[model samples]
Target chain A: MSVVYGRVALIGLGLIASSMAWGMRRAGLAEEIVGTARSAQTRETAREIGLCDRVVDTAAEAVKDADLVVLAVPVGVMGAVAEEIGPHLKQGATVSDVGSVKRAVIAAVGPHIPDGVNFIPAHPLAGTEHSGPRSGFAELFDNRFCLLVPAENSDRQAVDRLRAYWEGLGANVEEMDADHHDLVLAVTSHAPHLIAYTMVGVADDLRRVTDSEVIKYSAAGFRDFTRIAASDPTMWRDVFLTNKDATLEILGRFTEELFALQRAIRTGDGDMLFDYFTRTRAIRRSIIDAGQDTDAPDFGRSKVHP
Target chain B: MSVVYGRVALIGLGLIASSMAWGMRRAGLAEEIVGTARSAQTRETAREIGLCDRVVDTAAEAVKDADLVVLAVPVGVMGAVAEEIGPHLKQGATVSDVGSVKRAVIAAVGPHIPDGVNFIPAHPLAGTEHSGPRSGFAELFDNRFCLLVPAENSDRQAVDRLRAYWEGLGANVEEMDADHHDLVLAVTSHAPHLIAYTMVGVADDLRRVTDSEVIKYSAAGFRDFTRIAASDPTMWRDVFLTNKDATLEILGRFTEELFALQRAIRTGDGDMLFDYFTRTRAIRRSIIDAGQDTDAPDFGRSKVHP
Candidate 1:
């Protein structure tokens, strides 16, 4: 028989945590879920929204008897949340987080975790551009991958328990080091988001072109960047701050590549431009073949699940 | 009653022309739609797809008795197409185009135009990543803007006539100078596409990161860039070649902005990153208000589209 964690504590009621909470209740994976936030209004909101079984006013109250505690706040705030809840966590409990940049998060939150608790860091590679408690959906983890970065000295049983919880919510789990996670996400997500945010910002600053015109003409290419740029500001800000090294490393490579392309454009090197575009188109094909997304809106509604 | 053009000839059967053919037919705005392509295969495909009323082998044959001619090929091919059609165009005929880069296209095709022929350069700021006749849709122009770039010396009647033709196809027409059109699009469309293409290419070239992983985790942000990179290689190649100056200028601005953000990330400047993200988010909001796209999905049948 699958056992539900007796008292699960979620320190932040943001998109990832709220979704996890909803998923836990929906799957009956947790016997009782408790949540705490820095603001009283978020706690009340969590209670009203049924985000948790108990919405405690203080972090200490939230984690008092919890067997599992998840920190789903921005990476920059993970240390503070960890410090606030450190003394209150139940003995031998498993603690984890869903921060994008893992190394900084683990570095900041690791020292505060009690010696007995397993501090496993994980990231569920799924989300919409929207954020906050209300923006989360139970099916967000459907068909998605959860990356786990367990400490070398972490208890094996604790890792399995957390894996089971995520699997119950419909995720495929894999393990990697915190450094690898930061680098992978830096290339695939962080740098891409930064480029998008920058381009959208440039378009916004141009007085010669109206914002209406920019949006109206966005179908050509700009709308995609806008969607990416629309992602949570606070979350992204924290990501940039925490994953500074890897992100800057990727950004350096990105700018170098961009400069080469710019040089090709200035010199009217059609062959170079054509070759670059030709190579990238295959990547899109690979992404589709991997079943990451169904490219066919050519057919009817595929699924309305999430 | 808005009058249909006596005869409309489209030189080149690519995405833009195919879409225009569908849009014109659906709106019942063109008396006859004639198309011409360099390749026998493309002409056959155009005929098989029923994109135009008549698919001719020669541009001259297509433009012979036409009142309006639309050159919808690569920007690099515009001059040759214009030269072929110039002698065959009827007196008082309006000749226009759907090139992404305006000034270069105008300069290239301008010298070949007959004295009596009205060369009104226009670009429909619309397309999909897919190309060719099979991808055409009537509603492509329904809510899209068509920008017309007419020189100061151009005939007023011809410009008005071409405007009527596009408006009849359900496009809202806006008049702009060719130079200004190139500059605006260089910033909004061309440069953004180059950046996306470069980033995707960078990801493709990296050996440390697996392609499958990048594809799997793309919902983070990379999926959006593929949409632009998937565009026709030849067309985009030509766009970069023809709009070199303006694209490079905007690209310089983009690099400077990107470097500034990179430095902030390196310095762990959370305040700077937060403010930057917050500022960029507003532009997306304004774009949504402009009806370019929904806050989530800009395309139809997408989750964000209501």
Candidate 2:
């Protein structure tokens, strides 16, 4: 309810940063929110939408004298953004990033941090397929988990302050080591996203099943893959590139499992397919029970559309 | 609306059948609906919920004097249900089905239709992961598609009446041949379901990533796969077994495309990955434009949850 930071700097005006700005204002978590993006159009759009208290022209200008600076850029560009704003950061300012991958982010942004500045890597496990400034809302982070990956020698006060700030923005924050966080996300997010992209691509490339037919009959199941596959391309490309090792491991496992299921289907092994399907259903139940997803049928879309 | 059928018998009491019952009642499309199921508990649930005008204990009893008999059972069990009810069907009654795989259902149920009894196969492209009589909703077919696969010599009047009945139930109707219907569904529904099941199983089998972690962080994109994987096991198992060839073909294509994407990720070929992802996004746009899915971010869960 109170200000967690006197001044907050958001270095990318994409979905995450725009959402953070809206959520921060909703909870009065920051006295002043300054935002900037690499693209002039994005910066102009943010200003036009009143997304931040101050829409600066550059990351350097945005981070100047800010008590907390968050880099919400794609993983590939975190280093450049950090180098640009490093000198402008105020003394005792905490530097953090909302990148999907933490180990790569820490590696890229760690060197630019000054002696008194704290650099903590955090990933908010929340997003929609839609991207950009206009696609964000305050409820994006509500009831979602935000993992904070802080170094061993990081300042405790700074880490706690960042945790409080995210909590104020309606996220449940938990501390995770960089390596474990990457592996966990590889299984839960990266691998699944790549698989969805692959399936959607295959559907599109099939000559026999016309594109119109694919789109028209999508509600049977493929539409869900399209939704996941529609996520920001550059962001996801960086995710796969930076988190390559862990993601490849998960994909290897996924391919092996998929081949086995395909074999079962080919061999008419009904029991294997049935057992696998039954086991996976339990995990869905656990997700609903954990409050990570809605139990309403069809993700409660019937309610939304009706 | 006037009654489309004087008496309609539903041979299976699952999500599709129950939903049809509710939709029929909502539109007054059927004067009297008779339903039956293999499991006593399902029949009990249907009776308790008043899912039909009458709940019979056997498929034979349910089809007696019925003007339209719909075999709403699993793909694998369609033949047996058809055989059981064939003798009891009225002389001029029309026999239809709501199976996922049209060719297989046609093969399985075709031989049993006595002369003068019209046999037309239909598949409705609508459902949720939830199953059972209680999961049925009148609006389940609203704005969804229903494909009709009538035999070459089939009675034209019977097919027209069935199309009108589905239209009254709030679905758009289309005529598709059984073979093309099978292939289209293999790409859109069956293969997608198998891939989702495989991904969920891989996540569950990975001991390194605890189940709690997957459940907690599923909002990152994996939850959609879980929803698809949570569909009724028996129905999906039958779908895979009956539509084996087409599904295997699609899976082959999916695996090949996935390998290409994986190679790009391994080689750090960002352009290839980005291009593939961008193309997939266009298909998602088409699906949205076609009204096959909701465009709301996160499928509009934020609104439902907030």
**Candidates' lDDT values, in order?**
0.83, 0.90
Interface RMSD of each: 2.8, 2.9
How much native contact recovery, as a fraction, does model 2 achieve?
A: 0.85
Report the lDDT tens digits of candidate 1 across residue range B217-267: 776778778767878999999988888888888888888888888888887
lDDT of 1 by residue, A196-288 (tens): 999988888778777776876776788778878988899999998888888888888998898788788777788998988988888888877
Q: Give the DockQ (C-alpha) for candidate 1.
A: 0.54
Tell me the docking grade of candidate 1: medium
Question: Per-residue lDDT for B167-261 in model 2, tens only?
Answer: 99989999999889999999999999999999999999999989999999898889999999999999999999998889999999988898999
Candidate 1 scores an fnat of: 0.67
Model 2 misplaced regions, further than 4 Å = A297-306, B297-306
TM-score, one value per model: 0.94, 0.97
How much does candidate 2 score in TM-score?
0.97
User: What's each prediction's clash count?
Assistant: 1, 0
Which stretch of 10 consecutive residues in model 1 chain B shows the poorest summed lDDT? B297-306
Chain A TM-score, each candidate: 0.95, 0.97
